[model samples]
Target: MLLQLDIFNILIQGGKGLKPLAYRMRPQKIEDIVGQQHLVGPGKIIDRMVKARLLSSMILYGPPGTGKTSIASAIAGSTKYAFRTLNAATDSKKDLEIVAEEAKMSGTVVLMLDEIHRLTKPKQDFLLPHLEKGSIILIGATTENPYISINPAIRSRTQIYEVKPLTEEDIKQAIDRALADTENGLGKMNIELSSEAMTHLTQATHGDLRSTLNALELAAKSTAPDTKDGKVHIDLAIVEECLQKKALVQDKDGDAHYDVISAFQKSIRGSDTDAALHYLARLLEAGDLISVNRRLLTIAYEDVGLANPAAAARTVSAVTAAEKIGLPEARIPLANAVIELSISPKSNSAISAIDAAIADVRQGNYGDVPDTLKDAHYKGAEKLGHGTDYKFPHDFPHDWVKQTYLPAKIKERQYYHAKENGRIEQAFKKQYDLLRQAQRK
Candidate 1:
């Protein structure tokens, strides 16, 4: 009868018995929350807002599991404001209006939008009027940069709070808390985590609290049941088995992406084919197709221009091919193009010369475009003698003419410095020298 009673209790409890502990263990109050002391710690912006009961619409920008949602929930729990949660991934503009209407009827409504960056421009525009009127206090959480992802109009209205990742120490403390809190944690299992295991788990988690807790739960459950040891021991080997695969690689979203691409560009510029290929592979593998293409196109113009003009042509062809073929197979043509570009002799000051000339114009360092070069197509343009003295280069020898092209303020400005290493550039150098000598005579 006693044995039957024991089996019945186990059946009744089941997985629900263990899951509640995990759910209930979530920090109920902001004070109990781990990490993010910068925002939630005493005297911080969020801390002051909660304490003063003066909440406003804001954006929470950070990586995953950084307590963005949790902080929003904590605010809802502690305040008199009505909290409405919606995911931007699937939530529609109609849904937002519904929430706005609710706020109109009720008191202050805190609308928490998760993955807010995913919201389309039209959908984002829906919230603008309500945000302007302060009808609903929006709390938007996203992993991407709010500046890049959020509409400028919407961004202008919201205060952006940046959240940092949890530290290794913070992760360790969270693990210990999970083990000690029996109600919603591993405390009931009497698990004893070795220093080696603890270090492994902490380092492996990469400052994500949710992942660390989940790993701990898995390790604890995998322990041998027959062991007479009063305390459940988790070792490094056990942790390795539990984790199995390596942790996902971290991506630095904005400037870091550009920085990596820049490195790859410079490698190709310096003719370091190995380094260029490595960076290309890294970006391709990481799903930076648009970025890779942008750099490749730039390389085509700025590094391979004229010297081996085919290099630029090949890059464009490769990009077109990749667009049509897409991944795996596309990688091959892209790789071949990159290799050809790295080996090609290079020259490219054309764009830079134009850029400098434009800068001079913007600074008012130059006058109008030479009257000779102004458009003669317009009716009045010809009357103004726009093309009066224009020398058509094609009508002259070598499709070149020795004439003043710069404006009066910067007539002597030297641009288009030719690189002499490539045959195309060497020809250009010889032509330019001859033109200058003729002009001098």
Candidate 2:
């Protein structure tokens, strides 16, 4: 037991010896944490919890490098809890069993479960009982939404806190801390980062502190020292070369994926052409052509139904052209389709009419089909008085005939109410009103 304790201490205290700068610069205490001020600032719930040593099981959710794991480690440091880290993707259920056993022996254990959304059902089942008994203080970290991706049973037992992306100043603060700290940072070595380099690095990382630190470390390590002063000078050129290109933070299967698509559909539905095109660009940049295509097609039928029926055919053509040409070129046709849909007159009457009719049917309002409208082409259908009084519209002027198409119970029921959203629907509405007037006459 003493040997195990010694090993644990070594693992926790081994930050100074050779390790990644990001890992070494991890905040050891709550005050050292750079971002997430909402949860951990003075008088905040997490801060109060840590100060009082009354931490609870929590799942920290956010984008990558937003300090979920670091916050958990900080909590363990501040609360003096026995902290054990495990990778939910690689670690098996047996590892959790071991942690639970350790918690029993140690009285309490703060288990930092990284990528916890990947944890299997059996593993989660194992942890729940322990979580209820207060034996395991689980800190589940996930980049995806806990409500969407996490097991409901597990999520219900943990308080979920969303860790927001770090701001430029917050990231700069972290960069400065890493550069000046003599113990874990590169302060011993003389390194001067230019103002332009600082701005470029901070902005290029897109609020990801881990990427910023890693880029700083790369800039410091890769650059040769000046011969005269023996100091490393990181300029814009050096930072740019080290950082490469900025990456878009989009998860193909996560909340970001749904968010962009949702915004795209809403933009088109709301008739914001600029917003629609902007979201379309985002989807194209993220290489999510399928969602772009599927959503545009849905908008045509769902939002623009009957108002501009031609838009549906045009959208299908656009999708086919995009699929055939395949990206880069595909974005052109897709953009055209998005613009057309956004500007088209919007109406939902077709869908609403069908839905209202279906509701009445579901409520047991349906009756037998009218004899005139029933199938009359069969040999014995005529004997059943089907189509006996049916009037062919071809025999009447304007191909119009007013007759009871619905059952006697709902003979006067009207479902479709056309809107004058476009010229096509306007003409239909005019003809509909004339037909009703003629029927009254």
Native-referenced Cα lDDT, model 2: 0.83
lDDT of 2 by residue, 96-115 (tens): 98998899899999999999
Best by lDDT: 2
Over 4 Å off, model 2: 1-17, 246-441
lDDT of 1 by residue, 119-198 (tens): 88877778888887877889999987898888777788889999887777888888889898867777788787777777
Quote each prediction's TM-score: 0.52, 0.59
Best candidate, TM-score: 2
